[model samples]
Target: MSTPTVVLVHGAFADASSFRALIPELLADGIPVVAPAVPNRSLNGDAAYIASVVRQIEGDVVLVGHSYGGAVITVAGVEDNVRALVYLAGYALQEGESLGELQGGFPDSALATALVQTTYPLPDGSTGTDVSVDPTKVHDVFAQDVDPEITKVLAVSQRPLAAAAFGEPASAAAWKTKPSWGVVSSSDNTINPDVERHGYQRAGAKIVEIDSSHLVMLSHPKESADVVREAIRATDR
Candidate 1:
């Protein structure tokens, strides 16, 4: 049998490039990986766009989502090829759920306040949201475990998601049917560990916890990858 294909969907404020480093390692292990860059962070558009990519890859598939992308995959995982779903410190929005409402249960964190963006006039003089982070503080908040060079690159490469995606709701949650896997970052300050546990429990997914930050894949790639492989193996049994 051919190796199973993996589709990686990145979260808000990030594009497909977020998986650039992780993909190479997985590919080296003979896993076929595809990371589709979603346009402007619209989950609705993202799900539709990623589903298109999912249709093109052959064999059974494992859909992986990080942060907000988890919610995207949950909505998109209903596609025929998706055999398993993996959530990496990611959101798992349930049926008819929206991030706005879901976030209510979780206490606000420093990451929330740090996201305040300034609107500026674009080339056409139309005002648009231009998001930025306190570069000095990004390492501690986003990619502390990643190589300093990589963390700097990611800080500069991060994109500003349109405000609309946060309010977008999931119509159908695929995790209800597909077997799931979840990774919880115990030290995550952006996404509360308590909230992550709630999501993992709700999905009834096989769970793994790590004493890492929000970016667990970058912080603990080998372990994160191994957990993902286990999810793929679970589908075999």
Candidate 2:
């Protein structure tokens, strides 16, 4: 089989640019990659968008998702052409599982305390809550290992996730059928590392532990990219 185009999905409080450093490494090896901006609105809603992206691709696809992006691919990867999944400190929620349910089972991380919610206008004339890491706490709780200069920018510029997404159950769990790989950021102060471990273990994903913060791609791009490449190689049949 031909080398599959790698589709990257970023999680909450992040956008496609989060993969900035990693993309070059993959492209350097002649790898075709696409990192799409997710809406950070709702789980199923985001999944549908990503699924459409995958269906339009020319060849096979390896879906790589980080953080909440993991949950997005968990549903989007149900597309026929997605052959593998690479999870980067991502939520590998099961079908019928919600992020709140999975994370609530484990002890709270610094992120729980660091998050701040604000209201946004809704189409129906009601207000909805958007969740984001407190700008002052983002660097410490979300990406301590990342460069302060970068984290400072990320703190204020981070995308806010719709709070509703935390309760929405995933409609599909792609890792159940697709070959999957995972990276656990042992130093993560956002989602508890144990949550990452349990999610991957339940999905039967090949797993590795990286001693980095939630933003593993920034602090350990080579290692994170290595795991992604492994999934690509294993599924390129």
Candidate 3:
């Protein structure tokens, strides 16, 4: 069979470039990759958007979601061409569950206190709240393993997730049907690592625990790439 496309879906507070380090490794290994910018609007909308992207691809695809992206692929991976899923410190949410509902079951992490919420205007003249890590605490709350200088840039360029997204229920969970793998960022500050472990366990995904921050693909790209490869080998049938 032909090689499957590896579609990297990034979570809130990040964009496609979040996979910069891991992208190179996948490319060097002759793996085709596509890291798309996810609109952190709502769970249903983001999943529909990702599913559309997958539908446009020509061959089998492997979805790799980071953080919120994990939740995206959980809904999108049901696409017929999607062969597998790899969650890199991502949320493998269950059907009808909201991010807030899942996270609420676990104790709040540093992110709860570090969050900086602000309002943004909508086309209808209404406003909605966006949540991001306080820029001053971005390093400790997001990815402390990354360089301070990088975190400085991360602070300014980071994308904020729509607060409504958290409470919005997930319409579908592809992990329920697809072959899946999960990585736990054991040292994550933004999300309680237990949350990651619990979600993966529920999904029955092969789990890997890595000592790193929320940005596992950035700090542990080699190990990250290894798991992606393993997922491909096991499911690229």
Cα lDDT tens digits, model 1, 2-71, are 4689888888666777777678779888988888886654667778888888988877899999988888
Q: Write the per-residue lDDT of candidate 3 for residues 1-237, one digit (tens) a residue.
A: 568999999999988988989999999989999988999998889999999999999999999999999999998999999999999998999999999999999999998998888999999999999988889998988999998988888889988899999998888889888989999999999889999999999999999999999999998999999999999889856
Candidate 2 per-residue lDDT over residues 1-237, each given as its tens digit: 478899999999989889999999999988899999899999999999999999999989999999999999999999999999999999999999999999999999999888899999999999999999899998899889888999989988889999999999999999989999999999999989999999999999999999999999988999999998899878767
> Where is model 3 more than 4 Å wrong at Cα?
none
lDDT (0 to 1) per candidate? 0.81, 0.94, 0.93
Better of 1 and 3 by lDDT: 3
lDDT ranking, high to low: 2, 3, 1
In model 3, the clashing pairs are 74-174
The C-alpha TM-scores of every prediction are 0.91, 0.99, 0.98
Q: For residue 56, give model 2's deviation from the true position in Å.
A: 0.6
